[model samples]
Target: MIKIETPLTIDKVKCLKAGDEVLITGTMYTLRDAGHMRVIEQINKDEKLPFDMKNSIIYYVGPSPAKLGAVIGSAGPTTSYRMDEFTPALLELGLKGMIGKGARNKEVIQSMVKNTAVYFGAVGGAAALLASCIKSSEIIAYEDLGPEALRKLYVEDFPVIVVIDSLGKNIYEIEKEKYKIVE
Candidate 1:
């Protein structure tokens, strides 16, 4: 039942333990499958990334289309495991935090431990609820991709659980074991 007050940096984030709930403020960027692919291409070529990676959180999301007179439409986290291929490279670039649902791979967790990163899980099926926390959204890169566009999202008090910590502790592992129905 630990709570982490955010505007979090890598140092503060590395200290987070499993079972900690975080309230994230400041800014986050949204990038899903297409966006991740492009970033990885850039990384392989030793090209510069679109934004500062230090202490930043990347949300794995492809939001619902925006409705009329709305900042964004129903927005929520997508499955995170799909981004595993691209994540280690991004982590090497100093990317510290991720927000999404579900579990990541062994490599991703190992990279997090080596790099002192954290993974957070936002609630699933709460698209409309998640949208309320997003203050503004704009495409920062890869605009041709539509909803999969790389977006810089300004958010306040965004809620998430500390899924995996820098120390290699994972909430998903604990929860799975706790709830596993033995046959």
Candidate 2:
């Protein structure tokens, strides 16, 4: 398994391809739909963002409240398409990677190519299992959003697969074409 560091660089992100299995280390941030909307709204207003966008990785999740003595609880990815409207702006702002489940829209995928970004797919319905990988969590912004608040997370070897690479290659599209039946 290829291990990647946080705050990914352009070269580091470009090295990855569609279908690569990766274990990410260091820090990442969480942003569900509400968090995304806030960030995008800030961008639209030309206001400062809550965090730096350069080489950033945003995981689409809204973790349940932490259980007693746990750092976080039942954290898993949400449907990525819901955040597509805000994705291109983030990518344009230098976001190098994203972690979530499901396919992205064509505009987002095309933006990934233009911006040299990648989308990683985490296993859906694996919230309980994935929580173990997040070592720590802290509310970073928009605390009023509750479960959808932005969070800074330090992760260790968090598992994900490259569903869409910087070059615009996509596993979903490739698999569909590969399995298409000839009439």
* Candidate 1: Cα lDDT at 96: 87
lDDT of 1 by residue, 94-167 (tens): 88899999989999999999989999999988989989999899889999999999999988778888889998
| Every candidate's lDDT | 0.87, 0.93
Estimate candidate 1's alpha-carbon lDDT, on a 0 to 1 scale: 0.87
Tens-place lDDT digits, model 2, residues 1-183? 899998799999989999999999988999989898899889989999988999989999999999899999999999999999889989999999999999899999999999999999999989988999999999989999999999999999999999999999998889889899999
Per-candidate TM vs. native? 0.93, 0.96
Q: Among these predicted structures, which one has the highest TM-score?
A: 2
Candidate whose lDDT is highest: 2
